[model samples]
Target: MSIIQQMNSKLANMIAAGEVVDRPASVVKELVENSIDAKATNIMIEVIDMGMGSIIVTDNGMGMDFLDAHLAFDRHATSKIMDESDLGHIMTLGFRGEALAAIASVSKVTLKTRQENTEGIEVIYHGGIFVKDGTSTLNQGTVVEISDLFYNTPARFKYIKSDLAERQAIIDIFDRLALAHPNIRLTLVMDNKTIKSTYGTNDFYSLIDQIYGSKMTNGMTIFEQTVQKIHITGYLLSPQIARSRKKDISVFVNGRYIKNYKLVQAVIDGYHSFMMVGKYPIALIHLEIDPSLLDVNVHPQKYEVKFVNESILAYYIETYVKEALLKQTHQIPETLKNISKGLDETYIPLNLNFGEAVISESKPVYETQNTEKTPKLPDLEFVGIFSGTYILFQNEEGLYLMDQHAAAERIRYEHYFNSLAHPNPAVKHLLFPHHLQLTSDDISVISNHPKKMNAVGFYFNEQNDLVGLPIWLNDSEVEIAIEAMVSMIVEKDAIDLAILRDKLAKDISCKGAIKANKALSLSEINSIVKNLRACENPYTCPHGRPTLIKLSHHDIERMFKRVV
Candidate 1:
């Protein structure tokens, strides 16, 4: 084999670009992060052709001088840190310093910057080649324009999404940045249209209201705690406003947004009993700790961080969240605003043991049933109770048993399930508006699926961070029901009306049904029997558990040695 040689600088940069710059979104993240690291208070981002033709980011921060600009394109050159010691306590956003060089290697890049006190200068590079040296320009802030991205690397260009998808990715990055720093003003313009413009007023709550709506803002509960070198602060949704998805959970370390599953799971565990099975609560958490305890350089992109005391941190977060939820009462108020959108579109039916029986709006239809039309059973005989839950009966050729509670649950489950499938006219009016707390991440998830919620039998007003619940839930057990439903919604991305209805029915039955030891009157027993006989699966409940069991006379005789 021939001896191998070192790869060219341009080729090496292209490889680095593969790690830091995957799509238009990756480019946006790196550039925006640089702006943040420079302590930019005001940032404006513009994208053309969905970031395919060009992407521009302008920041009013501490810009670089001519020499700094030249060194900025060299790998491993960063103003944020010096050596390994600085790795433990990183406060700046862009530390790797490879972003600019990697990005320039695959695209046409023009970087123009001027220190607050120095004259502006510009440098242009095309496909890793320096075409134009430092030239006098006319600006105080830094303006980076990247054009024809992936030009040198044709293979990378093919993976770019459609214009709309790419545009959305840009918006997502912009939103995350804006959420992380509510004190900074941010502007995002796509194809000459402004999608978001925020004033740097330093009001985190108001900013949340603006982005997620007042409904969510109002429902949030402020969460603050300090434990053993870790200080946590953020907002959490009330139990009544729980979600089924983790999209609403946001975690930030120092000021950097991070994706830590352990931290997020800790938050979930904190709200465990407060929510129903399979539901998640919305949270926006910011953690402040000594940088020496964490490592942010684990990945090339730096979206994730590893903490030295990860287990301890998780325990603290979980305990904090749980205590906070328990200490507060999240009951729905009686004076909520009515914001029902109607049930015409949202409804699905689950096929169970019950059948739909229409009820007349006028007089009772059962009262006018013809006396002669009803047929009687020929020679049916009543038998004693078998198991405590079932009633036994006997006939000439068959023996039958029925479960009272199971029959009731099946009837209720089927009724609600079918109603959800084709929702009838719903009487909806909010009794009291509820404020939902959510993290910035949760807000992103909810914002993406407004139509899905509306398609279900429930409608909410996305104003003021407070979601207006359906009026039908007014008299119901408010907190538990809402939490359960939200949990279900989070588990299932879309709203399936039938599943929701069935869940609601199960919850209600579990809470309101008669217990096993309760005594029943003869009339009540007769009524239960009639209902059981009418049901399709009279021996089992909605949960698929057998409601009744029968032992024939022959089996009883064999046990007693009468038929041996």
Candidate 2:
């Protein structure tokens, strides 16, 4: 016998099942795509036991006849593509013809489909073996039910995650499908409870509202630009509406959801200076390109794609997204305007709750230091402090809101960082000694770093108390701040000098800054403003919160409806 003999059809299908039907979500994806290819206007997905027990997908599309329904179970049987040339211009979501056969191999499947004006046909299969085929009365569409997924493959079943995890996977795929085809009315029901529903109005914004609520929808900015045959259109969420993960960023190419990290980075780059580190913006980017220039067959799941001129495409997306964000500043919605109008603009503190830092009568002991001259930001006329927390200013360019605490934190961080870098050997003794009790190990750790601590302005006494405290901290807060520093040092076995210095600077800056709800005079506000303007990066505090936000003149006019 030849060593390389052809495998049996059943064995061949089981191998294909390894790729096509990895999980319950994979089965859902294949069936729903088939329904979409059939031009389904409304589709419904129902699941039980997190789709491990059973999954049913029903669609109101042009269904198949008896012969076609029977043939559908056969491997490589497809109505999507006819010849080699047809592959270049493939538009339908499903073209491989392998989904149905692969899906049938590992699980029990019951399919009922009826063409318009034709009698419905029901077919049954258990582990790719034909069980029964007969006529049935049904609506004009297709219904596929899959049960006991991966039953034939115990190894795959053993690796499956918990029920909750599997359900999340299913939900993720459904979200992508809904985003890609916003015109299709889609509903998902898990364990008899409806979790999602879309009206199929062909309005993408409405779909966004349905999925992420009205707040996110209102914060979104629309972007559209065409470069050659590639058409890019989508919405970018404002920086304020950011998430910790990239899960909210949705990208589709030619109506198929895909994962392209480079494209994702391009989208992030679009936010540029507007976004803080480790935060991702919500994106719904759609790309329409000639099928020939794009390749979607690389991944088994087809969630990744390859296209020509990727760099150029990324640049185009980045450029337009930047433009859209710039325009967003000048286009505040009426709802936001109405709310802003009710508030007193001159002294609207806007709730600046920066942590537990207290306001003390003692002032910061420092001289205004010189700075290297850089490009100057436009000067603003002081309008006084809002809520005793924010510094309000206005000029020809726009209205500016500066977080009092953040500005001081930024200034203190830079001041301490520079002092540490140059090693200022100045220690001012306090009139009253500060005391903190700690474990022996913590006391030993602090003793070892006495010089290092003193360098950062904390001189320790023999009794684990501070001989002198940092000038920045209030008398009452010095013990807590010293304990925090001691705890930080204790947590690490050995600390890098640079890392230690940075940590010290950060702690001191946070504790020393002016707190929210603390009143400030005009001279104090001017001093902070002037010092902030002189810093290298005064946009955000050391902790990465924006120190100031500008409401442009154009935005003010737009808010008042002075011009359309």
Most accurate candidate by lDDT: 2
lDDT (tens digit, per residue) of candidate 1 on 132-187: 86666655778999999998888889887655456556766776677788888888
lDDT of 2 by residue, 5-56 (tens): 8999999999988898888899999999999999999999999987888999
> Hey, what RMSD does candidate 1 come out at?
9.5
> In model 2, what is the error at residue 465, expressed in angstroms?
46
The clash count for each model shown is 38, 0
Which stretches of model 1 miss by more than 4 angstroms? Answer: 134-138, 162-165, 330-564
Q: How close is every model to the real structure, measured as TM-score?
A: 0.67, 0.64
Query: What are the Cα lDDT values of the candidates?
Result: 0.67, 0.74
Off by over 4 Å in 2: 1-5, 331-354, 357-564
